[model samples]
Every structure is written in structure tokens, then in C-alpha cells.
Target: MELKEKLNILADSAKYDASCSSSGSMRKGEIGSAHISGICHSFSADGRCISLLKILLTNVCIFDCKYCLNRRSNNIKRAMFTPEEICTITLNFYKRNYIEGLFLSSGIIKSPDYTMEQIIKTVELLRYKYHFGGYIHAKAIPGANMYLLKKLGSLVDRMSANVELPTEDGLKLLAPDKSSDKVSKIMQYVKNSQNKNFVPAGQSTQMIIGASRETDLDIMQKAEDMYQNYKLKRVFYSAYIPVNQDKCLPSLITPPLKRENRLYETDWLLRYYGFKVSDLLDDDNPNLNILVDPKASWALKHLDEFPKEINKASYQDLLRVPGIGVKSAKRIIKSRQYFRLEFKDLKRMGVVLKRSKYFITCNGKFDLNKEFLKKEFIEANLVLGEKANSSSNIYQLELFHE
Candidate 1:
């Protein structure tokens, strides 16, 4: 097959994996601006990444995962590229300024080990034969042997092990062949290689939201475990789109966006706002609060903890208040050390007094209606501020991607 034909098939197949980013790999004016933040050239029509030349090594899988579109039973077009072809395509794209790097994933062909080896060869060809220094992200197949991961890690910029589903039971129901424990173990192996300089960009994984029967709490717990255990760079959540029918999964038009937003909110809390998964969710609250963002929901539920003295509040203390974010809280911390802040001083510091005022005290005074009559207190109150905002949170993520 021609190289372009191979590119079309490979790129079409790889779209299923969402673990990607060109962030954190900074160079001092060498490889452009270093994207110290990150660079997503554009988002796709479906709101997915189109920055890198993302594609699969092949769509022909030996294993059959029921929820997947590329499974053996799905009867989709199949194509595979040789190592030289992949390396040549990547070099050509990079030279033409068409892409920053490559993102390669694949269906399980022959066996996990065999699929992984082909992936490793493509990247190795890029780095060695073609001398390509551009970024590369590859899949670390779950049950594939770990030694391959170790060698391939040094050749690629980042690697990911797709979690596929949230829970083991969810995995059993949708992808009976997948083992969550085995998958997590591969993540752990990748993580351990950090000191060896195996994968400096760090590992990431993906979870298909609203698929199967797993609750938000269940999904976030796994995310927390991945971050805490594997030190993963990210855990991407793709709101499941029903491209196929299954008796076991939901047949919704789109995965719940609000729930996805809620999870994003909850995820922000876990990574930046000093929250335990147990804090935001419990037996009573099986799913995240659909009405309020998780952070706002938690603050309201623990009302007694609020109305804190912003003038004297520590950095950690300010972050706990409903509306205070890392940036605003830092301003409060720095500004207060110099002067006793009044309500107006907070506004000057760019702190949203409307939301912050209720959760905080300026000179020992709280400004909030005892009735607090906004219909959805979190939105009308928190977002729309009493007003609106997490800088080390979601906005950070959007900026990180942009």
C-alpha cells in the first residue's frame, strides 16, 4: 500500500485512544516555545485532539472486546504499516509542519506482545533511523510484557495504558477479555520506571465515561488510585458515545455532559484542591452532585467550615473556602501579609467577593443571605459568585491544552 493510504487507515483506527498532550516537555527556545503549557493545534469537530498525527498500527485485532468498534467481530476495514512506512510518514509530516508528533495505538493483533513489538518498532524507526526528535505517544498494552515497555519507554516521549472501563465488573461486563487488575499493574510498572528515566513525560490513561454501569464515584476512585500510585500525568475521560449497541451498556445520545462536567470538577478537587475521593463521595452520594460542581457541593455540605477570615487565612485555609482558587487565594495570602484586608481590598485583589464573601469573613464579618435564596446555590451563588471560578483546576487544564 502507498504511504498515504497506510496513513489514512492507521489514523482512522487510532482515534479511540484519548491519552495525549504536548505539555511539560519544555525546551529553552529550541523546539519552538516549548509549549511550557502545551499546544493543541485544534480540537476536532467532536471536541477531540487533532494536534498530533494520531493513528493505529493496525485495526485487525485477535482479541475481541465487545464494547469496542475495532474488535474482531466488528467487520471494519483493516490495515497495518511497516516500521519504515510509519517512520517516513512521521518525518514527512514533521518537515511539512503538518504535525508536532505522533500518537500511535492499535488493536490487539496476534497477541499483546506482538502488537506491542510492532508499535515499538515504529517508534524506534522514528527515533533511530529517521533521527526524529519530535514527541511520540504510544500505547503500553495491558498484558504485554514489561521488558518491552522499559526499552520502548526510552524511545517515546509518553506512554499510556487505557483503563477502558472504570470497574473490574464493568470490564467483565463490557470487555470480558480485559483484566482491570492486570491493566493497573502495567501502569504501576510504567510508574516505577520514572527514576530510570524510562518515560520522562510520564504516563496517562483513559476512561470511557457513562459506559457500563460504573458510577462517577467508582470512576474517580480509580483515577485517584492511578494518580497516587502510578504518578500518571493524566487520566482522560471520554464521555462515551454509543457507536454500537450493547445489552450491558447505556444507549444514551451522548454520555451525560453535566455528569462529565461534574467529574471534571471532582477531578480538579482531587488533583489540586486537597480533597480525598471519600470526602466528595460516599455511600449516600453514590454519584457526584449533578446540580452543583463537586467543589461547591462539598463546601455547602460543610457549611460550618466556611466564613473564614480571609485577612488572616493561610494559603491552605483560603483554598478550602467555596469561591477561592489557587490564584485568588494566593493573592489573598500575599495581600493580607501587608495590610488588613477589608471587603473592597479583596475585590481589588481580583477575588470574587460575591462567592468568597459568603465563605469568608472580612474583618470578622460574613456577607450572605441567611435565606441564600438562589435556586441552584452552587451556580447562582458560586459560579454566577454569590458570583463565579480553580486555576490549578479545570481552567488550568483548558489553558494547559490550548
Candidate 2:
């Protein structure tokens, strides 16, 4: 087939992998060209954000991963770009200012080593032959040779080996060919090899949510372990998009976008808010409350700890508040040194007063007028257009966009 045909097929094929941030919009019109056709945005080593030409080396697979569109059993159109062809396309795209980098991933073509070699060759051509100095994020094949990984790491700006599912049982049931141990070993290799010359932007991994019977708590526990063990830069959660008919998978038409968002919120809490996985949920409540964010849920659950004086609270305490972000928390710490903060001052400092007011106090006085029962508070928060509502707005926003 022609290169353009391959590009179209492979680009569409690449969309299923959610390892990078995607501006989920299809802005195709008589105007500018920002349509979501495999063009994705990623951050650079120096924090300069750039768009990447996200595509797959091939969509032909050896292993039959049941959830994947390009599984061996799936009768989908397949395409593979030669390394030279990929380099030429990347260079041409770069010259036209279409993208600043490339994000390359591939299905196992013949073997993991062969696939890795093809990926490496493409990167090599881009770097040496084309003299392309742009960012490249490459996926390391799970059981590929260590030397190929080292070479790929040397060439790419960021490297990731996706932990496709959350738990071992999930992996065994859904992707029996993929070993979690192999993926972990690759992660450890990248973590150990990270230095000035290798993978400067660090390593990240993607996890498929709701793919199996893994609860939100189970996912978070796995995420925490990955962070602590592999020292990953980020654990991206891709809500399971049902594409094939399988007995093992959930029978859902829509992706669990809300659940995915909640997981992200919990991830933010764990990474920045100093929240442990155990602190977010227990055995009784294995899932996150979709109506409210994890932070607000935590605050509501531990009401006795609240009405915390903003002026006296530590940085960690400030982060635990429903609406206080890292920036606002830092601002509060710096601004409180100058004067005693009121609720208005908190608002001025970027704290969301509607949600925080129930859990915080200003100048030793409660801003909450009446005693709100937990049920009432949750209901009030869930009401549309109320300032207390943030998570539910996601559903409205998705509807508006759709």
C-alpha cells in the first residue's frame, strides 16, 4: 500500500494508546488544522511544550491481546512504515511545522527485538541521517533485548513501557502473553539508566482502567507500588474503550471517563497532596465517589479534622482542603506571613471557597452558616451549577463538547 494510506491507518490505530495527554477535540472546519488525527502534545525536557506526530510503526501483532484493536484475532487493516519512510515523513512534517517531535509505538512484528530494532532504526535515521534534534518518546517493548532498550533510551527523550493492566490476575486473564515482571524490569532499567545523556524527561507508564475486575482502590494500590518501586514519572490511566466482543471484558458502549478522571484526581492527591493510597479508600469503599473529587470526599469523610484554621495550618494541611491546590497552598503559606487571612483573602489567593468553606475556617470563625449533614453536603455538591460541584461538571462539559 501507499505511504499515505499507511499513515492514515497507523495514525488512527495509534489513537487507542493513551500514554500522552490528548486534547479530546476534533476541531475540523474551514479554518485552521488542529483536528485530532494522531497529533498529540507532550512536554519537553526543559518544560517547553511541543506537539508530537504520534503514530505506530506497525499495527500487525504476534500476541493476541484481547482488548487491543490490532490483536492477532482481529481482522483489522494492518500497516507498517519502514524506518526510512517514518524518518522522511517525520522530517517533512517537522519542516512544515506540523509537529515538533515523534511518539513511536508498535505491535510485536515478528518478535519484540525486531520491533524494537525497527523503532530504533527510525529514531536513528531521524537523529543521525536527518539531524533531527526534536523530542522523541519511544515505547520499550516489554521483553525486548536490554541492549536495544539502552540504544532506544540513548536516542529518545522519554521512554515508557506500559503496564497494560492493573493487577497480575488481570494480566493473566486478559493478556496472558504479557508478563508484568518483564514490564517492571524494563521500568527498573530505565530508572537506573536515567542521566544527563539518557531519557532526560524520565519514564512514564500507562494503565488500562476498567479493563478487568480491578477496583479503583486496586488500581491506586498498584499505582502507588509502581511509583515507589519503579519510580515512574507518571502512571497514565486510560479508561477501557470496548472495541471487541470478548467474554472477559465489560459490556460497555462508553468509556468510563468519569472513573478515569477520578483516578487522575486520586493520583494528583497521592503525588502532590501527600495522600497515601490507604488514606483515599478502604476495603468497604473500593471505588472513588464519581460525584465529588477525591480530595473533597476525603475532607467530607474526615469532618472532625476540618474547620482547620487556614492561618495556622501547615502546607500539608492546606493541601488536604477541598479546593486548595499546590499553587494556592504555597500562596497561602507566603501570604499568611504578611497578614491574617479572611475567607475573601483565601478566595483572592486562588482557593475555591465554595468547597473549602465547609472544611476550613478563617480567623478562628466558621464560614459555614448551618450544620450540613453528610448526605445534605453531598447532595448540595452534586447539584449542577453549584460552586461546590466540580467533578459532575465534567459530565456536563463532555456532553456540551459532544
Candidate 3:
């Protein structure tokens, strides 16, 4: 088949993999440079939009993952890109300023080792033969040979071995061919490897949300484990999109976009704001509140902790307050050293006072009247604010754009 035809087929097939962000990798060589920015119009840590040419090496698979569109039983057009073809496309796209890097994933071909070898060969061709040194994020085939995984890690900026479902039971029910242990082994390998160059951007994994019967607590606990044990760079949450009919899978018409957003917000809390999974969830409340963001939900429940005096609260205390993000919290700390802060100053410092006002007091003055401090009133207003900003609350990792 022609290269364009192959590209069209493989790229479309690769769309479901959401672990394609390309931040935290920086490499410069003769042909291209991988910046700290991400792919698919994603903003970097420093907030610059970038793009990548995301595609699959091949769509033919040995495993029949029920959630996957390219599962062996599915009737989809199959295409494979030779190592030379991939290098050609990546370099051409880089030279034309169309993309800053490549995000490559593939289905298991003959075996895990064979598929991994093919992917490694393609990356090797790009790095050594063409001197293309852009941000390449490759998927590590779970159960691939250890040597191949290490070799691929050295060549690419980032690598991921997706733990497709949240729990072992979910894996057994929906994707029996895959094992959570294999994915964990890959992460363990990346973590234990002594080589400084092994995946300089570190490793990340993707988990499909709302697929099986796992609660948000189950998913976040799993993510927290990956972060603590594997030292993973990211644990991407892709809301399940019903593509194939199966008795085992949820028969939802639309993806649970709100749940996905709440997960991301909760993830941010865990990573940056020093929140434990236990702090936000319990046996009674296993799932996140879909109405308000995780931080706001927590603030509403723990009203006794508020209204924290803004001027006297420590940096950690400031972060715990609703609507105060990392940047704004830091700003609050640095600015409070200069003068006594008030509500107007917080708004200027980028705090979402609509939510924070219910929980914080600026210099002994309540932003809202004490009568409005009731949990029901606060929850209602927060929910209304969330509905007003509903369009912007949904977060999905964009892998490609026209």
C-alpha cells in the first residue's frame, strides 16, 4: 500500500491510546529537538502548545482485548509501516514544521518480543540513521523481552506500558489476554534500571476509566500506587468510549467525561497538593463527586477546617483551600510576606474566590455572609459554578489534529 494510505489506516487505529503527551523530554540533535512542550496541541509545563505525528507501527494483533477497537476479532483495515517508512514520515513532518515529534504505539504482532523489536528498529532508524532527535514517546509492549524494553527506553524520550484497566478483576473480565503483572514488571524495570538515559522523561501509563465496575477510589488508589511504587511520570485516565458491542462492557452511549475530569483534578491534588486518597474518599464515598471538582468537594465536606485565615495559613494550608492551585498558592505565600492580604488581592493572585470564599477568610473578614456558610448553600453554589463552566471542565488528551 502507498505510504499515505498506510498512514491514514494506522493513525486512525492508534487514536484510542491516550498516553501520548510529550512533556519532560529535551534532546537536541542534527535533525530535530524535543522540547519540554507536549504533543497534540497540548501545553507544556511552561505552557507552550506543540504537536506530534502520532501513529501505530501496525494494527494487526495476536490479543483480542475487548475494549480495543483494533482487537483481532474486529473488522478494521490493517496497515504496517516499515522502519524506513516511519523514519521518512517523522523526518518529513519535522522538516515541514508540521510536528515536533512522534508518538508510536502498536498492537502485538507475532509476539510481544517481535512487536517490540519492530518498534525498536523504527526508533533506532530515526535516531541513528536519520539523526532525528525529537520527542519520541513509544509504547512498551507488556511481556516484551527485558533487553528490548531497556533498549527502546534508551532510544525514546518516554515509554509507557498501559495497565488498561484499574484492577486485576477488571483485567480478567474484559481483557483476559493481558495481565496487570506484566505491566507492573515493565514499570518496575524502568524504575530499577541504573542507566541514567533509560527513558529520560520517565515512564507513564494509561488506564481506561468507566470500563469495568471499578470505582473512582479504586482507580485513584491504583494511580497512587503507580506513582509511589513505579515513580511513574503520569497515569493518564482515558474515559471509556463504547466502540464495540460486548456483554461484559458498559453499554453507555457517551463517555463519562465528567468522571474523567474529576479524576484528573483528583490526580493533580495527589501529585501537587499533598492529598492522600483516604483524605478525599472512603467506604461510604468511593467515587468522586461529579458535580464539583475534587478539591471543592473536599472543602465542602471538611467545612470545620475552614474558614482558614489567609494571612496566617502556611503554604500547605493555602494549597488545601478550594480554588488555590499550585501557582496561586505560591503567589499567596510570596505576596503575603509583603502585606496583609484581602479578598481582592486573592482574586488578583488567580484564586477562584467563587469556591474559596466559602472556605477562607482574608484578614478576619468573611468573603461571604455567615448565613451562606451552610453546607447545602455552599454545595449548591459550587455546583452551579461547575455547570456554568461545564464546557471547559472536560479534559481529554488530544492525540491528533487535522
Question: Highest lDDT, which number?
Answer: 3
Q: lDDT per model, in order?
A: 0.75, 0.81, 0.86
**lDDT digits (tens) for residues 233-306 of candidate 1:** 88888777676776777777435555676787777888888889999898788887554567777777787776
TM-score of each: 0.87, 0.88, 0.93
lDDT score at residue 379, model 2, on the 0-100 scale: 47
* lDDT against true structure, model 1: 0.75
Q: Candidate 3 lDDT, tens digit per residue, 1-402?
A: 999999999988887776656778778889887777654545556233447778999999989989998999999889899999999888988898788798899989999999999999999999898888788889999998999988999999888889988899999998999999999999999998725477988899999998899999899999999999999989989889999999999897568766887899999999999999999998899988776788888888888888889999988998998888899989988988999998999999899998888888987989878999899998999888867765542322221110
Residue-pair clashes, model 1: 5
Clashing pairs in 1: 307-359, 383-387, 383-388, 384-387, 385-388
Better of 2 and 3 by lDDT: 3
Model 3 ranges off by over 4 Å: 39-50, 194-196, 391-402
Across residues 1-402, which tens digit of lDDT does each residue of candidate 2 receive?
999999999987887666653232222222123333335455656343447778999999999988998899999899899999998888788777767567899999999999999999999887777677766788999899999999999887779988888888999999988999999999999999888568766788988987899999889998999899877878999888898999998887567787888899999999999999999888999988766678877877787787789999999998998878999999999998999899888888889876677778888887766566364664467343243345445565544443
